[model samples]
Target: MFGPEGPSLRELAVQALSSVEHGYDLLAPKFDRTPFRTSGRVLDAVARALAPLGPFDDGLDLCCGTGAGVRVLAGLCRRAAVGVDFSAGMLDVARHQVRAADGPAIGWVRGDARALPFTAAFDLVVSFGAFGHFLPRELPGLFARVHSVLRPGGRFAFPLPAPAPASDPLFWTLLGFDAVMRVRNALWWPRFVMYYRTFRLGTVSAELARAGFTTELRALPEFGRRADGSPRVRLVVATKPTTQQGS
Candidate 1:
């Protein structure tokens, strides 16, 4: 629906009718062509912001999806960069998309984010545009999963845009989309779960805190400030405490 190479409307309809996992599996090959892939501009801004926070040894890109975030990791991290996703097709694209000069070796692992397979292995972790696939109730478990993979004092980060107000057309557009998806799920099996408004800042911060990470938001100046002077984009930086033992 985005460009000549992007999926057509009929193909999108077929995807929307499938379960979330299966839908992504079906869409994986052309996913990067669609507008859904995180943009190069956003990726560059994120990498620039994260550079000061690094010298990180290893980094992981959760729900990597065609390796957009993996590129960011390859630039920020020194030793290795890994991309994890459930779709093999997506991983295939990532394997090819991530061939830059000499840097951390790029690795792709096919796995679900809810049950990641690692323990204190990554010094930094990042995700982009995949949160809507996760329902709010899953945040605790998901955050815990991320926590288990990060080294102590390591940060799990992502960029979050401020919610659109009711006055904005984007607000109603997202609301309508969520409502339609709910109806689609009610009539369909193996539900697809993606909602725009579900993961607000307050709920996310609380979940991160519950999962044992102290979280903060860092504004990305590259995206520029909004009309009211608030940042257009902010990075949610959640840090696992240095001492894992009971405080």
Candidate 2:
């Protein structure tokens, strides 16, 4: 249990045994109370980093679980802010939880991220803390879908923490957790595809480039630097170029 209101062990086990969508659906109500939700620190840091580039008219929060990142989108976009996710339960919770107090008119849509139901519609898009559900092989298609939904010169942004060093205990913990997940999925019926170590920046950058994004990494200075002086976390700002190659 993470806190007084967090899901109990039995609830977590039941959800974990279910498919990814179902699991999230079951967790929707208590998701913010759990550690799985993106932290306010990260959201605030991202909002600050993105503010200069925005005054954007339209924005999308991809895989917008319970609408955490929608709060960030609302701050930057002027006219419309949309949150899209496949889990109807999650969207239902989001609809009630988030309100358009200011910034932009907010809306929630139920849809799959791999096959998003929009094209060149948004000037900006962001996702937070949901990449682990996607496998390494899915990056190309996922990035392509994000690209397709963005208007020319639109930006797809997300925060990526630096991988824990090999000597760090967190590194081994994630490695072991991923191993356990592999074994569990092998033995289970509905596989829960959440692996923390699969999305490496090198592979992700290459995939984004392949999907027609020009990628840039902006330091999230609020999180500070590591021992090596590299940023503890960096925001990946991958843009869909305004001009076509042949044009």
Candidate 3:
């Protein structure tokens, strides 16, 4: 769903046909007006979940998009907050839009998430709604990049909602969306690469472990629980080890 300020159907179709970076560039101007931007409620929930574990230093927002996650980092990190994304257009919008009045100084860098342009410079890293762009096979490298950027004992965190049950319409909707994306990728030139079903908790945890992170899951109580009494949403906090270990 989009607002009056959001991209039109024709504009969306055009974006769908373009490569991921270029598509996001085209959408950057109106990204905040669309459902694609991470919601304020979700941002607040993640911030609340991360607050206790922090007193963090510098923070990096991987694949920061229009810089929503950077806003969260600004409040939590004591030093500086940096947002990195491949899309120059998105970074431009973020530079103009996101501002921290008093907390941390904010900076923007344009770089690929797979080959992030940083070392162990960050005490915390956060990402929001950007994983679906990465294929399942890319998880290891992606996690590794996040790990590389973090200082020892640093955290890479993001919120993940519980998968919908089979009986729920949302489940089918996501399934259908993934199915359509598969077909589109198969038929199109530059694949859009957004899928709803690929990222799973079990797989992600294992990958995080392989990438040298000790992972933790903290339930976001604001979203409540499912009928089965499991959390409706969780914040995945993957911490880089304080000491070196054989990979």
Candidate 4:
């Protein structure tokens, strides 16, 4: 699903063999051209979903590769929007690619998601298509970092796609992808940690609660529904409570 402007197969092989940071650095230049980039449709849908709850002041885009999520923040946040990631190369492209002349001021920082550099600095935080890099066991610490960066009553929001049913080809596709990743990590160093099946809604909600966020899910109707009337995707909005008793 890569375009001509995307990385070559050889280039992708090199990246897959490298550490996550170095791999992203090598892929950063052509990232937006690849399917790895968060789709504009998804971004627009998220922006629409988040608009009612916001008029937010400052926003942060955690694990913001190429700053696609920052564009959403610029529309919803009034003051400033900052994108943070570990890849300097991605930030470099973001610096040159993402700009808002009249909206919120955009800035980029090189940092890890596990240990963010800010404390209660953001009123809203959003991430897109980056969670697979983190293993299930890491969710607690990662959510805690997001919680620490957000002011009380602030939100950490992201779109969560519904899992494919067993009858669907995508189900097998993702299952196989995760299996390959597991095998590869078992046999390789500097593990490239991308898995499709590990992040489940129940587990994520529990972790967010442990991190002091009251979690809720809003259906994104644009993606329509399954035969069972379940939403195809949802926006997970986890808010840090305003008071000790969870308000």
Candidate 5:
């Protein structure tokens, strides 16, 4: 359901076939217009939730696409903020989109998420809507890399919506989409790994714990409850142990 400003059908086809980095690079210019970019509502809500935990000195936005998540970092962080992504095209748009005074000074870097280039240089690290680019097996390296970049007592936070059950139509929609993705990747080269269903809560929570984090799931009340009364949105706040060794 991309809006009129989102990528065209031909554009989507090209991105789907390319490697994740190249795909994002091709889509970056129009990314903010797509459903892929983090929403302003979600970002503001996360900023509010994060405010209590911070007064952060420096921040990093991991896999920062178009820098929407960096704006949240800017709210809590005082000094400098950085955004890293493999896609240079994404960084270019992020550079132009999110600039404000009384906020953290934003800088962009081109880098892979699985092998971050910095060490213990940040008080906060955040990502939005980019986890799907990583396969389940890749979470260990990716999370470890995020952990490495964070200073003692620093956090790596992101939002995770509660999943729809099998009975729900949305669940089937997502399942079908993921199945299609699997088929496409099986038949193609430069596979795009983005899929919503693969990032389930229990598995992810375990991975976060394995990556040396004390994790918490904070319910987002603003998004309201599901039919079963579970919060529709949640913030996964995973903190690197304050005593973690610095590089």
Candidate 6:
């Protein structure tokens, strides 16, 4: 649907009608060629933001679609970097596409994000452009899963673009796209979940706090600022506290 090398319109329709996991499995081979893959520019910006903060031992890319986030992790982590995703096809492609050039050892695991297999094992966790697959109600459990897998003082980071203003055509474009998705899910079985506007940062920040993260936002100047002087993109830097507190 995106380009000549990308999936066709019919192929995208078939994917959208399938379950989210299965749809990604179908799209895996062409995923990087499609615009659906996170941009290298964003990845480089995130890597720059994170590089100064770490001499991290191990890192994980949650919902690591084709291991794009793993590239950033490889550069920053000293020991190892792991990419975890539910789709075997995606992981297969990731295993082939990502390599450590004198960087950390890289590996891939197949798993669901809501129930990650590890516990307090990673020094850093990062995700790129994978959050919309999760519904808003799932935030608490999802953030808790991230919190549980990270060691004390570890950071969970991802870039979040500011919501488009009402005057912007892209704003309404996303709004209309989400409306169509709502109708699609209502009538379909094995619903595909991807919504651009549903993951609100204010709600997400509060949920991260509830999940025991001390959350903060850092402006990604690479994406530049909005006319209102706020950043067009901000990195959500949610840190697990160094000392444990009573649950």
Each model's TM-score, in the order given? 0.96, 0.98, 0.97, 0.98, 0.95, 0.97
Best by lDDT: 4
Candidate 4 segments exceeding 4 Å error: none
Stretches off by above 4 angstroms in model 5 are 244-247
- lDDT of prediction 3: 0.94
Clashes of each: 0, 0, 0, 0, 0, 0
Model 2 alpha-carbon drift over 4 Å, by segment: none
Per-residue alpha-carbon lDDT of candidate 2 for residues 1-247, written as tens digits (9 for 90 to 100):
3997999999999998999999999999898899889999999999999999877999999999999999888889999999999998899999998899956999988999999999799999999988999999899999999999999999999999999999999999999999989999999979999999998999999999999999999999999998999999999999999998679
Alpha carbon deviation, residue 209, candidate 5 (Å)? 1.4
lDDT of 3 at 11: 96
lDDT of 6 by residue, 1-247 (tens): 3879899889888999999999999999989888889999999999999988898999999999999999899989999999999999999999899987798999899999999999899999999999999999999999999999999999999999999999999999999999999999999998899999989998999999999999889999899988989999999999999997874
For each candidate, what is the lDDT?
0.90, 0.94, 0.94, 0.94, 0.89, 0.93
lDDT of each residue in 1-247, candidate 5, tens digit only: 7888889999999999998889989999998888877888999989999999988999999899898888878878999889999999999999898886877788889999888889789999998888888899998888888888888789999999999878989999989999999999999998988898888889889998998999999998889998998889999999988775573
Query: How well does candidate 6 match the true structure in TM-score terms?
Result: 0.97
Give the winner by lDDT: 3 or 4: 4
Which lDDT tens digits does candidate 4 get at residues 1-247? 9888899999999999888999999999999999889999999999999999987999999999999999899999999999999999999999999987999889899999999999899999999989999999999999999999999899999999999999999999999999988998999998999888998999999999999899999999889999999999999999998887833
Question: Model 6 segments beyond 4 Å from truth?
Answer: none
Overall local distance difference test of candidate 6: 0.93
> Cα RMSD to native, each candidate?
1.3, 0.9, 1.3, 1.1, 2.0, 1.3
